[model samples]
Target: MNDEPKSISIKDIAEALNISIGTVDRALHGRRGVSEKTKTRVLKTAEQMGYKPNLAAQALKLNRRISIGVVLPKHISYFFDPLRAGIRAAAGAAMGSQISLEFHEYPRIGSGDIEALEAAHARKYDGLIFLPGDIQRFSPLIRKISRSGTPMMCVGSDAPDTGRIGSVSAHAYISGSIAAELLAHKLPRKANVAILTGELSTLDHAEKLSGFAATLAIQAPHLTLMPTLEGHEKPKEAYRQALTLMRQKDRPEGLYLSTANSIAVIEALEELGLLGKVQVVATDLFQDLATLIKSNKILATLYQRPFTQGKVAFENLVAYLTRGNLESPVVQLAPHIVLRSNLPLFASRISETDEGEPESDSLE
Candidate 1:
């Protein structure tokens, strides 16, 4: 007979304001040690959201500290750093002092992901979050972890067949399709376009390559698709291969760097004096990439929103762990296209504040 709205709690208020629950509790109770500014904001938000505190539920939730393990790559700091920030930001806002995050970092994607993953699995934390370098290689272990009744959240990439709970990443296929369409319109004279990817073995990279090829064939038949180059996400290898590709007699007129490792490839283009000559669509954004986009050296970039991905992955994993929110197993966020005209909008967020190392947040 009664169908009414659920009462708002301190957690909801904390999440809305992106602050700790303890701070909200302190502010709402007129307790000492909370800033006046924060107290005023909390009161305003509580009144606006129609807060009805449940003291018993708040005390019960605060008694348990959830331990979470985060495993991600260390090589590509440009993308992974913001991702770490996002996770930390989410944990701080939602769980406050009731969460313990143990971040484990490996050398690169393919190099040490498995070892770190296995070690994290051994710990048997409340939930696990990681990026899968090779889906096949990670599937068995992920399946085992899943069988152990642990929830795992994959970020940046996915192991679909594995028994992991879910994933949060960019739309890899759409990212490639956007790049192909951009290049097709940029170069309409039956020119050659090449894709420089990290490793096709990875699902994300393979999907991007496939989408680019399929779209290029359908949208621009005049343009020839060159053999996809794999850099293994190594800076030196990418630079060397880029140099070799650019120096070829029949070099591509357009290039799609489908990984965040564009600086080295861009450097190679600069060395070969092909910055303006060749149209480039890079993946992800950084300060240098923004400058290049502004100068017309790079036509545009696909902003993958690594910070948002990390934040979403953490939030989703926590939700599933606490409330069994497993409605969507895979969460794919759309990519943003950044061009010369709109480079200023992302300039502030792309600025590097720290070294972007996940090891800094380690529990050990």
Candidate 2:
């Protein structure tokens, strides 16, 4: 009686193809109960008639909804905000279609963090997105997620051993290397440079430092880089620590920071009235810092694509769910360079040369 061609139903297909309902059902499930010839004939006819399964109706009949879980730290990260916006946009686009999404925030990986992660992951979500804070300590948690048979994506960090289904992380070593190379090009030949950072593990602090050092060796051999100062990735705390370094008499001409709490450091520079005295470069972008770049309070920043990450992660999950490609490939979306000259083209171009290619420093 109902004539809605928009809805593809099993009953509709069976009736149109003049097949018994039982035969169609068995063909749909690939049941061993049906004869091989009947199964092939029924499926061929269904395909020829443009038969399509309704995920929503199927889920209702089977009593299982496609669910996805996302985990993130609750700290005030300027990058995460935009990333969240992208994630919501991507998920909302898929709403009332196939999947349901849930978001969980844990401020840090503390005493009960593992328990919390486990509990949230225990839900029968089809997939997961995680910002893994500390990989070494969180290895067990990662393993647990892997064993749960749900595809997992690691954003901001690469968790290779944990069976991460995909990753969308910045090329940290290359970002830091670019800062060093660019600073050399912009500054005086003998100028001294210094670096400030958060904990080395979380921000890929060590890898960035390696890039900076390597780039410095080839492009600005005469330049000097002071010892790295740990800033704890907090604005006020980093500002306080930076005060001592900023006041030093033969202060470095370039200040490099690969940090999570860069706002305070920039403010500290302003307070010292040394805003333009030292060129500064950092790892991520913020609204205020982009303003500073236009005003020349900061020199350059290597921008990572968090928004693209959310989109890619969701796509990975969707592919795994509908297609049954359970072991989804690990994908790393490239990073971007954000300078005052070009904030508009944030994630357009490739940030660095691929790691596989043999590259030697060139002073251009």
Candidate 3:
């Protein structure tokens, strides 16, 4: 009464096609030594037989455990938390790969990043996933680590002309352009707009400022651009700068928080009772940001896909290390613009955190 198809294995595929088991295995696994015509035949036969390769079993054959070092900032947990979540999700997907992820957290970018890099380098991991702060400061160290045989994969931002094998991040320049375009439309009349961001030494923050300034000059020439306020992603510093910027005689009509450290600036805006009066464009999203968005306190946010960036970075690094697939790919995900109208679609991704606090544990 039961007529179900059995699972097809490589042996079944080889037998069905009258080929050697070794040839079938080599072709299926993309191992060299198999002819092109034979590989095509084996692939066709495997597909026709509905064979599925077990990645875990394939990895088990390698007889080695892969270890990865992840170095990221502890500040701005609103973005970094989801980034770690993504890396964990990717590691989970590759279960039985015998992969170990070691997370090393620094206070913030440009602070303890170099020390963390040195510590992780001493361990001699197979690969590293890192967020580069200042290119000039990190170039020599990254090159040293690479020359020592560990591949470095940059995430969140890039350090070019260095030894980084690949990078995965949201398009930072486009995020700024989007913010500028949004504010330009909201304030059709001549108005002043200011950018609140992190240190200019960080590549991502600098790129965002560049994009916003360029777009404002081209599309919204009537809008006056104010001097950038660099809080260096410190909460107290950001709050103080924001408060001063808002209280100035030449107060800006529009504000763009280019970094994920928007809560402090938002609090300052609230303190000055300029919540709804000033059009504010924030970065990333959390529970508090969602509430603010619904209450019209914030206009829009450019959601950088942090989780995807981490997931892709981990997956690509694994592929490069295990399969010798050194494509050195640079993946740039487009920033998701979240408005009040379509906020519900992105509700599932929002983390339930009132404050941006970093996690304590380093090993997982």
Candidate 4:
């Protein structure tokens, strides 16, 4: 009574097409030494036969396991925690395959980062995903790695001039422009604005500041720009600098936080009783920041979608290694503006705790 056709196999495909099994295998798996005409014929024949690859069997056939390395800074736990979770989730989904991930965390983006990169290079991983701290400082190392023919994907920031294979991140420049637009609309005509950013050595922070400044210059020419304060991504230092800035005779009327230290800045404002006096536009999302947004202490924030960035960075490297499909050199995801009206939607998505994992659902 059973009339369904039997499953197709490589041997079945080869016999049906009057070709050798080895030739069929090479063509199907996209291996070298197979002619174009022969590959076309073999693929067409396999398709006609309703063939499907047995992934378990394919895994067994693979003799070597693919290895990938991820290097990131540990100081910025708020951002890197979700990023690591995303990579882990992706690795779990790919458990069936023989892919292993090695994570390397550094204290900051200087000597420690360089050491991690060198160690990963020495280990000879099939692919690497990293948060490049300073393009100029790391470009030499990156160039050396590229010369060895190992694929590298920059996650968070980019080093275009250094010959990186690709990069996955939110558009930092656009995020800054959005902040500028929001502040320009909220503040007075001649309001003084100051920027608090991480080190300018990093490209992402630099790009964000540049975009914000450029937009303000064009859109709100009357608003005066103040000297930037480098927080160095330290909360205590940021708090101190913010306090000093707020106590000045002609303190800034608007503050643009280009980093993820909004809490420190807000605390300083609250201490100075300037929380409601100054307009604030910040980057990234956190529980406290969301609360402030709801209470009107902070105006809005641009969500960077760090989870998606991490997930895509790992997936792209795996795809390049297994299928020879190279991703675009620069994959920039658009930033989402979260205001009081739509804060609830994003609040549900952001992690409640600092080390908590992000939601499994894909970001919009």
Q: After superposition, how far is residue 102 of candidate 3 from its true place, in Å?
A: 1.3
* Candidate 2: residue 3 lDDT (0-100): 25
Error of 1 at 306 (Å): 0.5
Error of 1 at 213 (Å): 0.8
Model 3: per-residue Cα lDDT over 228-291, one tens digit each: 9999878899999999999999899999999999899999999999998999999998889999
Model 1: how far is 165 from its true place, Å? Answer: 0.6
Q: What ranges in model 1 sit over 4 Å off? A: 1-62, 353-364
Q: Give a tens-digit lDDT track for model 2, residues 188-297.
A: 57988988887665535666888898899888898898888876555676888788888888778898888646878878888989986788987776667767777877
Clash tally, candidates in order:
0, 0, 0, 0
Which residue pairs show backbone clashes in model 1?
Answer: none
Where does candidate 3 stray beyond 4 Å?
Answer: 1-61, 95-97, 326-328, 352-364
lDDT of each: 0.84, 0.68, 0.84, 0.80
TM-score of predicted structure 2: 0.73
TM-scores for every candidate against the unseen true structure: 0.80, 0.73, 0.81, 0.80
**Local lDDT at 358 for model 1:** 24
Alpha-carbon deviation at 113 in model 3, angstroms: 1.3
Candidate closer to the true structure by lDDT (higher is better), 1 or 2: 1
